[model samples]
Target: MDLRVLEYFLMAAEEGSITHASELLHVSQPTVSRQLIELEKELGKTLFTRTHKNVSLTQEGLLFRETAREILALYQKAMRENTGAETLAGDIYLGMGETGSVVFLMEQIAVFRERHPGVHFHLISENADRICEDIEKGLLDVGFIMRKANPLTFEILEMGLRETWGLLVPEGHPLENATSVTGKQLRREKLILPENSFFQSELLRYLGAGAQERVGATYNLIYNAFPLAKASRELIVCLGYPGERQGGLIFIPFANGKDAYASLIWKKRPVQNPALAAFLEHIGHTVSE
Candidate 1:
């Protein structure tokens, strides 16, 4: 298949009309339509469905669209790398969990910006499993995850920080005065927890038996639970309690000694973007020092 024809297909897919794609590509409508037909024959897939008014992708077309976009992005990236641009410039997609060690990662990013101002960072905060999912799908280049990741899939770098688990409750609650809490105490109240399936299982195991039934709600972002927690008596159990109390909530550490550590990970790629490679090298040198 021709690269130019792939662009024509992508344009038509985006614009939803062969005439619109022809206008954008500065080609005749018949030319664009002919190329699309040839592309379908070459791939043996009906990439689009047409109506009198417009066009849309089929299920196979949707899947192919995603793959084609990634291919174009990578091809452009390779060309940029070979062109020998003096300054490093590209987007770094990173996913992470909420951990105190993120401050350390930010510090590295801060210093890295001084040398290569052209580099940009995109950060997504999520649990270990979701982070790993995005990395495996090639959507993310790196992730800062809490707890151990699958060694078979990632090149892991231990971040050397541990996060203590704790409960967040309204101020003046009975548990507020306690230095630490126990599994039995955690079971006594309606609990708000993280929505990650793997982490939920870990929490259940840590809390021992009978704690799962007390779960009141689960949240993707911990902050979203705070409003509900303030409005009611529900208590949230989470890691790395915030230093400054907010919304009249108090954080008390768990007494049972369960804690989680942070790790930086990426898919074991044979080749990586120069910008990403530079950032990883910077992290290594900074950590060693």
Candidate 2:
């Protein structure tokens, strides 16, 4: 298929309206509409659901959107590599979750940038699963994951810091005054936990069998569950950092020796960009030291 047509398809898909995409692309609405029709015809699938004013991607279209984005990204990366700039000049995308080790990562980033200022870092704050997906799709160069890395798929470097798992509780809760809590103590309370298979598995491993039944709510993003914690007296299980305090919330560490660890992970493939290579080298040196 034509790359230009794919660009039009992606623009329409993103904007959710052909007219809006036309305005952004500085092309006529009819032109974008015609290109989209041609793309759908060439692909032999209906990519979008049409309405009077807006459009939405169909199931097939959603799948194709991911493929199309990867295609465009690969094309851009190829162009940058071909430029052959002497200075390190390319984008480094990193996916991160809520971890205190972010400060350490940023310190290393600062050290790297001091010598190569042309490199730019793009940090995407997301959950572990989403970060893994982005890394697999080649959209992100590095990921900070709380779980152990898959030895088959990833090259791992531990951050040398461990995240102490804890409870984020509101005022007047029974466990609010406690310095640290046990798994049995946590099992007694209604829990609001991170909505990830690996995280849930780890929690269950720590809390023992039948603890899954006590989970009241699961959230993809930790902070999004704050409202639920406030509305009820439920407890949230997450990491506790030094001097870190949230408004109307208190964090108490878990006493049962269940702490989450972070690692800098990347796909086991040939290095592509100079910036990524430098960052990887820096991580290796940092971890070694």
Candidate 3:
């Protein structure tokens, strides 16, 4: 029931003998046996079968062994991060709005891991709103979102030095040749759109006000843009990204450059986790260069 008991049970299972488990745990053999018995009693199942010569796990024991391992792994990671080992090793739960910036993050993470082997990451990708909400709830320690998002609940770590958002297009699309197009040209085609955020509403307002009509097809997120556009080579998706240089689709820069504003968000307080701090530093460096 207690974590300490689970630790003892897991150690006993791993070492395969009370004597060895006690030696590794730096406790007496009887202490190890007593704790293991207490653990089995609490679980209401036999964790091991022991004899004069050998010890082995029962069916329940095997299952518990894996669960114990997972629990211990998480605990160890948390303790290390909380204790400042995060400078050299820790885990970070990060969220980002899907963008080509992920490739950039990956590159920096690879370098960070090589330099400091102790740090690990569990990264999630989502649209900007959810990223902010998760950070507020502590599900994420740090996040990335469109720079113009309301940041009353979070802190902006960096701003306005990211890549341009471009159009997602199919081959042979007419606008492919154009470097930038007006809101008038965009409304004439099927455009992929984001949800009802300030980003989307503001862009639509500018496009419609500029051209006096709707601009392209509407969708919830940039990823949704791909599916709608894929069906028709004639359909073009207007999205924000460091869009592909050249490919199945065209990357048309936004004329007003409205799509380029995105920022990194996190709780307004200093992050207590060392791994997160280091990771944030690495990302900041990557953003700068």
Give the TM-score ranking, best first: 1, 2, 3
Candidate order by lDDT, decreasing, is: 1, 2, 3
Weakest lDDT window of 10 consecutive positions for candidate 1: 240-249
TM-score to native of every candidate shown: 0.77, 0.71, 0.62
> Which residue ranges in model 1 land beyond 4 Å of their true spot?
1-84, 241-244
Q: Model 2, 1-289: lDDT tens per residue?
A: 7787778988898789999999999989999999899888989999999999999999788778757765665666677678964466656889998667788899989999998898889988888888887777666778988888678988888877887888888988877778788887765788888877888888778876668888999887777888899998888888876325666778888786567788889877654455687788988888898
Q: What is the lDDT of candidate 3?
A: 0.67
Q: Best candidate per TM-score, number?
A: 1
What are the lDDT scores of the predictions, listed in order? 0.81, 0.81, 0.67
Better of 1 and 3 by lDDT: 1
Give the root-mean-square deviation of each candidate in angstroms. 4.2, 4.4, 10.0
Tell me the spans in candidate 3 whose CA falls farther than 4 Å from its real position: 1-87, 149-151, 209-224, 233-247, 284-289
Local error of candidate 2 at residue 79 (angstroms): 9.7
Put down candidate 1 lDDT per residue, 21-77, tens digits, no spaces. 999999999999999888888899998999986788887777676566556656767
Residue 255 local lDDT, model 1 = 88
Worst 10 residues of 3 by lDDT: 234-243
Indicate the TM-score of model 2: 0.71
